[model samples]
Target: MLFSLVKKDLLLAKKYLMFMTIFSFVSPLLIASRSSFSDTGFVSLLITVLLTEYILYISISSLEDKSKGAALLCTTPYKRNGVIKAKYLLILIIFMCCFILYTILTYLGISPNIQQMSITKIGTIMLVLSIFFGILIPVQVKFGYEKTKYIGFIIVFLTPFVLPNLIKWYTSSNLSINFTISLSQNIYGWIPFVLSLIIGYISMQVSIRIYSKKDL
Candidate 1:
């Protein structure tokens, strides 16, 4: 049943999925072209992975909200919990798809740097995704995607401006300096990787609670 719901969403968002695929293929070249930095490979990989997930997830949520499909889904055997579970499952699937595409691009030599994606990079990417989905899913479940998307836009626009300051603050602070240093070690990837999965699980629970109580 959960798989069916995932399949339904995928089918409904096929056009957006196609767009995501195209973006995944072209983003590396575009990002590499725009940046002369040595870390352009990492930058390209990060953007490609993050944006692909963003496009698919946002499109699915928007499609559901715009069509008033959530209310209808709740009326079916799927119900609210199933609907919420399907969303999380869909996100997991999307992440895997992105990783596979990344691997293929690397193998095909289309990616900027074949060796750029490592376990540490994967862990960092997953951590970022966990935080994003953790906040985004519950908020969207409560308010619907149409309303939450503006906030999404604001964050996307402000992140570059805010991130450097935040990093500087963190580096200057002694409180989390050790933790930050530890994360920089490649061997610690498993720690954040585990934490990412936990965050994703908790996020799903929160979204389920929000959607369950939602009037829609």
Candidate 2:
């Protein structure tokens, strides 16, 4: 039953997935051809682009079902938990595919040195992105595409501006307070990505409960 749900989702999202894959490949080429392209810069750009692609994919995929009013799946022999699990499983599959593609690009000299970022930092980044993607998925499901798009835009646009200032203010006022302890010491040298993953999972579960009760 879960497999069927996942299959349905993939079928519905086939076009967007293809576009994303092509974009992932072409984006690196465009970045590499730019005047400022260094190994580090290329890799950073690739990661950023790929992250945005994955988040958008997950959000759109979740919205597809809601937009179509696919209530039949909810009435099947499968439980709502199974449906949610399938979505997460799909997310894992997407993550693995993106990771493999990124690795290949690194090996081909299209990106930076993979070893530059330690495993812990890399893991943390992946975890944080995964959690964020997870959170966005449920919101997309709950709110549908239009409202979720506004919320998503606000988050994507405002976070970059807000977080730096927040960090600067915190560090400026309390150097002796040891902000590093509160932050993740791993890959990006910041807060543990595991924290985001934990929160995201809890939020996803909450979304599942709410979606199960929804009319459609």
Candidate 3:
């Protein structure tokens, strides 16, 4: 049943997947060519992956809301928990597909200076997705996409542009505490992956409960 739901979503969002594939490949090329952000291949790769994932994520939600699909599904044999599981599963599948495509492109020298996509890089992307969807999915389950779209936009679209400056300011400010922890440290390096798994699990549980009890 969960597999059917995921397949349905994939079919519904096929156009979105195609659009994102093009966007993913083109954006990195543009970013790599730009003098401003072209400082590193990693930066361009990060932007491509994050933007693609966020777009696909919202596309599914928008489709569901517009079609009244979730409410309709509730009237069928599809359990609400299964529906929620399918959403998380679909997003995870999308994330993996994007990662693999980008990884292949990186190897093909699509992004300048990036020879390979590292494990740490993968972990970082997973962490960001886990947290991004963690908060948004439950809110979306509770309130529907209309009320949550703006928040998603701010987090996924606006935050990236402003985050660097915010980080710079926070680092430069004379705060009471200031220190740096290198991701090179073995313990620190694995933290992102660990947190991502934990957060993903908790987020799934929360979304399942919210959806199960929802008056759909």
Indicate which candidate wins on lDDT: 3
Q: Give a tens-digit lDDT track for model 3, residues 66-85.
A: 89998899789988889888
Runs in model 3 lying further than 4 Å from the true structure: 35-39, 164-188
Error of 3 at 87 (Å): 1.3
Candidate 2 residues lying further than 4 Å off, grouped into runs, are 1-3, 29-69, 111-116, 154-193
Q: Is candidate 1 or candidate 2 better by lDDT?
A: 1
**TM-score of candidate 3 on Cα atoms, chains taken together:** 0.83
| Order by lDDT, highest first | 3, 1, 2
**Each candidate: what lDDT?**
0.75, 0.59, 0.76
Give a tens-digit lDDT track for model 2, residues 40-100. Answer: 3334433544455555455545666566635666667777777777777666566556656
* Worst lDDT 10-window in candidate 1: 175-184
The model with the greater lDDT, 1 or 3, is: 3
lDDT of 1 by residue, 109-200 (tens): 86545434667768777888789878988988887787899776676545544544564565568555344553455567677688889999
Better of 1 and 2 by TM-score: 1
Give the lDDT of residue 148 in candidate 1: 91
